[model samples]
Target: MDSVNFELANDGIWTVTQLNRQVGQLLEANFSRIWVRGEISNFTQAASGHWYFSIKDEGAAVKAVMFRGRAQATGFIPKPGERFEFRVNVTLYEPRGDYQLQVESMRRAGRGDLHEAFLILKEKLAAEGLFDQGRKREIKPMPLAVGVVTSMAAAALRDVLTALARRAPHVPVIIYPAPVQGMDSAGKLVQALQDAIARNEVDTLLLVRGGGSLEDLWSFNDETLARTIASSPIPIISGVGHETDFTIADFVADLRAPTPTAAAELSCRTRQTCLNQVDAAFNALTVSQHRLLERAGLRLDRAVACLVSPQQRLQQQNERLQVLKSRLARAASAPHDRHAARLALIRAKLAHAQPRLPELRNELNRQIQHLSTSTQRLIERRGQRLKAASQTLEALSPKNILERGYAIVRNEDGEIIKNALDLSVGERLAVELGQGSLQANVLQVHALL
Candidate 1:
C-alpha cells in the first residue's frame, strides 16, 4: 500500500511554514488567557532580556516564555524549584511548530484549601474577640521565669534555649514537652498550655515552632488550642514558623513573635537592657553625690566668711585706724598742696613766656605811625572814588535837564503828572525846578492834543 499523505489540498500543495502558521493562528484564536499553577524549573534568561522556563506539577510540564517587557512589569525574577501561579497565553511557535505558553505575569502560589480554612477560622475567632487587644494579657517586661511548650527533640526548642540563655539567662526556663507537628499535635499543645498555667511556675509562656508549609503549621491553627492559649492565666507569646507565617495561635496569644527564639526573648528583659538600666542608675547616684559635695563646700565657705576671732578683729581695727589717719592727714594738707601746685604751674608758664614791656611799647609806637599814614592814604583814595561817582551823577542828573528849562510837576497827591488828565483844573501841584520845588495851582482847563 502507498504511504498516506496529509497534504493541504488535492489542487495545491501547502509548505511547512504555511501549515505551522495556520495551526498557530487557530490555536491562538481557540484558547483564551488562562492561569497555571506549578513549580518553576529550567529557568533561563537571554541577553536580549527575555525569559525561558518550564512550569511543572507532579506529573505534567509545559514550556513557557516571558518577553522582556512583561518580565520587567512582573517585578520579580523567578528562580528554579520555586512555586508560582502564572498567567499565560497558549500558542504554537510557528518557526518550530512547537506548542508553548507565553507568560503574561507570575505570582507566588496560594496555599489552596488549607489557606481558605485558615482564613475562615481566623475570621471566626476574630469576630469572637479572641484577637482583641483588650482580651489579651500583658507579658511582664521583667519576668521571673519563662515556660516553653515544644517538643524536646525539635529544633525549635533548641532555638528557644539558645535565645533564652543568651538574652535572659537569669530567668529560669521550664520546658513543657509537646508535639509541635502532626495531626495529634494540637491536643498535646493544648494540654501543655493548660499544665503550665496550672503549675504557675512561670510568669510568661512561649509556644514556638519552626517554619514550614501551611500543612505543617496546621496544628497551631486548631480552634481548641487557640482558645486555650487565649485563656491562659500566664501571658503566652506565640512564635510559630517564620515572620511571614501567622497561625491562629499568633492571634490568640498575648504577643506574637516572628520565630521561636524571638518568643523566648520576648518573655524577659535582655541582658544588655538590664546593664543599661544599671549604668543609668549609677550615673544618677554619681551626679547626686557631686551635688551634695558642692553644697557642703558652699556651706563651709559661708561659715568661713562669717567667722571672726578676737585677735583678727583687733588687727582689722588697727589697719582701719591707720588708713583713716593717713586720709585725715592728707585732707588737712590738701588746700596748701593744691595752692602750691597751682603756683608752680603759673611760675613755669611765666618763665616759658617772659614779656618785654619796653620792646612792645616801641613796636606800638611804630604801628600807630604806620596806621596814621595808611588812614591818610585810604582817605585820599576814598575821596577820589567819591569824586568820580559825583561826576557820573552830575552827568545823569534830572536837575541838569530842569536847568535846561525842563520842570518836573507833581499832582496834589505827590504823584508825577505825565498826562494832562492826571492834573485836573484848579488842582494844586508842586513844580520841581533845578534848584527848588514850587507849589502851583492849575488855573485854566487847557486841552492840548
Candidate 2:
C-alpha cells in the first residue's frame, strides 16, 4: 500500500451531522417528485397533526410522512392496510440520517377500471330505487331462525357463528352454503339467496365475508346478486368486510353492518335482551289483569248493592198498598163525619122553632134519608176507586207481569236487560219468572229497529 497523507483538519474530517446533511442534500438533488403505490401500514398521527406511516408492497416497505397542511387538504383520514397511491418526494432525515418519502397527496389505488364499473352499477341500482331507505325491510327484533349465506370455509362464517352462539344460543341457525370468492361466486351466491327465499324457513338472513382486495371482493359487486338481495322476502343483513370496505350487496341489503360479527348481532337480539323483553311483557300482563279484576270487583259490588230479590220487591209493594188502603179509609170516614155534624146543627135550629116542628121533622126525616143515601153513594164510590187503584197496582207489578207468562231478563252482572241488543250470543243471562229463576245463554240477538 502506498503511504497515505494525513489531513486531520476540522474542515477535512467529517462529523456525523455533516455527513448526514451532505447525504440528504445529495438525495434531494438526485430525486424529484414521483408517484408511488402501496398499502398503508403502521399509521400514526401526531399531536402536531403530521401523519406518519409506512407504504408497503408484498416484498418491501418504506417510511413515509405527510405534514398537517397536506393531510388537511387531502380531505381523508387514511386507515391502516388500505392501498393508496402517493405523490411523494424522496428525502432523508438529516438528524437521524434515515431515508424516507414526503407524501404530497394520495388517492385510492387500483380504482381505475374496477372503480368505474362499481360506480356504473351503483348508479344504475340507486336510480332504480334499490337503495331507498323506504324500500328496506325492518330487521326482526326476535328472529325465530337465522340463515347465513356464505362459504363454509370462510373465516367470516366462523366469526358469525361464534358471535351468534355467544349472543343467541336459543335461536336456531341455518347455513346456506355458497362460495364467497372466485369467479363463479356471484352466481352461486344468487342461487343460495334464491334457495333461502324459496324455503322461507328463516326470518332473517346474513350475507357476510372477510375483508379483501378490490378484486377479491368484486364478486359481491355483481348486479344480479344485488337484485336478488333486493328481492328477498327475508330481511338480509350484509356484512361484507372491514369498517371501511363496502360492496353493492351492502347497499341493496335491508341492513348493513361493518363486520361479520356485527351482522350476527343485527340479525336478532341477544338471548338476555329477549328474556328481558319477555319479563317486561309478563309484568305488564300481570298488572293489566290485576287492574281488570279490580274493576270487575267494583262493578260487581255496585250491582250487588242495587240488586233486590223479586220476593222482597213484591213484599215492599204490598206494604205500600196496605198503607194506601188505610189512607183511603181515613179519607172516606172524614167526609162522612163532616156531613153528620152539619145535620146535627140543622136539627138544633128545628128544635128552636116549635110551631113548625111537625113540618120540620118531616123535612128532617127526608133530609136524613137523602144524607144517608149520599153517604152510602160516597162510600161506594170511594171503595170502587180504591179497588181500581189496587187493581192497577197489581197489573203494573213486576211480580204480576212475570206471572203472566213474562220474564225479567238480566245479564250475568245482574243488570236488567230491556233490549235484545244489550245481549250477545253465548252470553249468560238470568231470567226471573213468577215462581223460579233460570240461567240461559243467548242464542241470537235481533234489533227491533
Candidate 3:
C-alpha cells in the first residue's frame, strides 16, 4: 500500500488508513460531545471488558463502544432492547474505516431531561450557598418531639413511627400529613413543614418517603421546598427514597438519612442509652462529692494541729507591752536632757565670742581717715586731666584757625569755596574772619597755573 501525504502530494489520493484518519479528525472537530437516546441492540462485552453495542430507535441506528474504563463505571450492565441515553463523541475506527460513537457515560432513557433540570437547579442553589455545610444546622441530640412530613398513606410514616417507638417511646411524635407524590405535592409539603415550624413543638423534623424513580420523587426536589427546608428554624432530617437515591431536600436539610427509620433513630437517644448516661453522671457527681469532703477534712485537721492556747498568747502579749513601756520612759526624758546640755554649751560659746565696742570704734575711725585721703587724691588727678582736655579743644577750634590769619570764602549759597575755579565772575561771596564777617563781589577770577 502506498501512503500519500495530504500536505505534500498535489494530487488528492490516499490509503485506507490516511482517509479514515482524516475523516475522524473532521468528525471530531465539527461535532462536540452529545447525548443520544435509543434502545440497545446487539450488545456484547469483549474479553478485555470493552463494550460494543448498537443504539437504535424506530428509524435509525448507530454503532457505539464504551471502553473498559467507562464500561466498568456505568454500574448498570447494558442489555439488548433496553432503552438508554448515552453521552458520546463521534469518531471513525481507523482499522475498519467505520463511523461510530465513543461512549463517555450512560443513563436511563427518560432521565436525561429530568437529570438535566435537576443539575440546573442544583447548580443555581449551590451558587447561592444553599448547600454549604457551614450553613447546615446540627440535628438535636435529644428532641422533645419528632415531627414527620409525609402522605398519610405513605409506608415511610409507619416505618418512622415504629422506629421511634422502639428507640425513644418517651419522645412524642407529631404527624404533618401531606401528599408525597402527585401534582402540587411540593406546595403541600412546604405548608406542612411550615406548620411544624410555627407550632415549634418538635425539636427535630423528618421529611421522608419510600424509594421511587426520579419523577416520582421530584416533589422533594422542588426549589420552593428546598428553600423552605433551608430556612426552617427547627432542624430537619431528610430521609427520602433508598440509600442510593438523592434529592435536593437531602442537600438542603440539616441532616440526611438513608432511610425513614434511620431519620427516626437519629432524632433522639434510645431509652436505655439515656438511662446509661444518667447513671454515669450520677456516679461522677458522687465521686466528686466524696473527694471534696475528704479534702475539707484534711484542711480542718491541719488547722487544728496548728492551734495555740489563749493563755500562752495573752502572756506573750503582756511581755511585749512591758518592753514597749520601758522604751517609752527612756524616750520621754532623753530628749530633754540632751536639749539642756546643748543650751549650756551654746551660752558659753556666746560669752567667749562677744564683740568689743571700743576696739571696733577705733578700727572704723581709721578706715574713715584712709577713705578721706583716697578721695582727695582722686579729685586732684581728675582736675589735671580736665586741664589737658581743655588745652586740646582750644587747639582744634575754628576761631583759632581764623585768628592764625586764614580767611574763609563762601559762595552766594553760603557753601565754602576751596578752589579759585569755584568762584564765577560777578558772583557775591561772604568773607569770614576772626572778629567780623563781610560780603564781597568777584571782580576777576584768579587761577594759579
Candidate 4:
C-alpha cells in the first residue's frame, strides 16, 4: 500500500465522546500525579463512601473524586468552603472524556507543608535530647515580669493580654513587637528574644501566635529561633497556632501551651487565688493564736487564785500570837497551885497503892532473872547446833575427798565422771589433788564391770 499523507486541520468535526476521549488521553499522558491548591466547593459525601467535590480558585476549577479507600485513609474530612491542598492522579473518563483528579491524600493548605516540617524538626530535636523533659527548665511560680514576643496587633496578643488581665493583672508585661510570619519572621523573633534578655525587662518570656496555616507559623520553626529559645536564660512558654499545630519552638521552650491565652495564663500567678490562700492561712493562724492566748489567760487566773494572799498570812500569824499570850497568862497565875494540886493527887494515889507497888517490884525482878536465864540457855543451844552443822558441811566438802588421797578426775570442761565408760582415749581430763589441779589426756581406756 502506498503511504497516505494528511494535513492536520482544526475544522474537523468531532463527536462529544470523541473530543472527551481525546482530552482524557492527553490529560492522562501528560500528567500522572500533581499537587493542587484550592477552595473546596459542591462537596458531597455519598452513601457509597466516596467523596465528590469541585476544587476552585479565582481563575480555574476542577472536578475531584476520592474513592472510599483513599478517603478512609485520610485523617481528616473536608467541609465545603474549606481550603485544601491535595496530591492527586490526573485522568480522563473515556465515556465523557471528562478531565478530573483522583485524590490520594489531602490536608489544610499551607499547614500541610508546615506540619510536615514541624514533624521532621521535632523528631530530629528529640533524637538529640533537646526536647527531653529532663532538659526543660521549670517555670517560676510567680514571675515578677514577663516578656511577650508577638505581633503587637495580632489577635493572639490581644487574647494574651485579656487572659493576663483576668488571671494576674499585677504581672508586668513587656511587649516585644515582632512579625509573626513571612520571610524574615524567624530572624525578628530571635532578635526579640535576645533583646528581652539583654534589657532584663522580664524574668520569663512568652512566644505566641494565633492559629493559622503551616506557612503562617513558619517563624517558630526557624533553626535560629529554636536555638535561641533553647538557650534563653529566661524561661519561655511557646503558644503557636492551634492545639493540633506543633512547632519546633514548642519542643525547645521551657513550656508549651496550646494557645496564646494559655501562654499568658502560664506566665503569671493567679493573684486572686494566691490572695485567697494567704487569707485562709492568716485566718487559721489567728484562730490558733487566739485559742492559745485564751488557754494561757485561764492558767494565769487559776494560778493567781491558788497563790496565798498577804492578808491571809497576817491573820494566821495574829491567831498564833493570841494563843501564845493566853498560855503565858495562865502559867503566871497558877504555877504553884497547879503543882500543889498535882502533888496532892499523887500522894493520894501513892497511899492507896503502896503495898501493891512493893509486890509488883519483886515480881518484876523475878521475871527479869527468868528472862536472862532463858536467853543464856538459847544462846548455848544455838551455838552447839551451829558447830555441828559446820562439822557436817566440812566432812561433805570436795576438798576432804582430795585430802583423803582420792583425786577427782574431770573432763577439761570440768565435768566429773564416776564411771570408767565415760573415759575416751585422746580426751583431756583434769585431776584434782589436795592442793591443785592437773590436766592429762587419756592414754587408754578399759571398761570393766
TM-score of each: 0.48, 0.54, 0.56, 0.48
Question: Please, what are the lDDT tens digits per residue for candidate 1 over residues 299-361?
Answer: 656755675554665566566657755665666756887756765775575455444456755
Q: Rank the candidates by TM-score, best first.
A: 3, 2, 4, 1
Off by over 4 Å in 3: 1-35, 39-82, 92-100, 103-112, 309-449
TM-score of 1: 0.48
lDDT of 3 at 412: 85
Residue-level lDDT tens digits of model 2 in 325-402: 566556675677775665466456444532444574587568656755765676567557656755763564456767
Candidates in descending lDDT order: 2, 3, 1, 4
Per-residue lDDT of model 4, residues 1-449, tens digit only: 23333333477777677666666666766676788899999999999999999999999999999999988756346778888888888898877657789998887886786556666777787788878788778898778788899997688988887788677766667899999998798999899899998998788899999987567877888878988888888889999987766778987899999899999888877977766765676567557656765675676577557756546655766666577556656667677888567657755754563344456557756865675576567656755765675576467455676799999788865555667777788999888899898888889888885
Off by over 4 Å in 2: 1-35, 38-42, 45-112, 123-129, 308-449
**lDDT for each of the candidates?**
0.80, 0.83, 0.82, 0.78
Model 2 pairs in collision: none
Error of 3 at 5 (Å): 10
What are the clash counts of all predictions, listed in order? 0, 0, 0, 2
Residue pairs in candidate 1 whose N, alpha carbon or C atoms collide under 3 angstroms:
none
Candidate number of the best lDDT: 2
- Over 4 Å off in model 1, which ranges? 1-54, 57-60, 63-112, 132-139, 296-449
For residues 42-92, write the lDDT of model 3, one tens digit per residue. 999999999999999999998999999988756447669878888899998
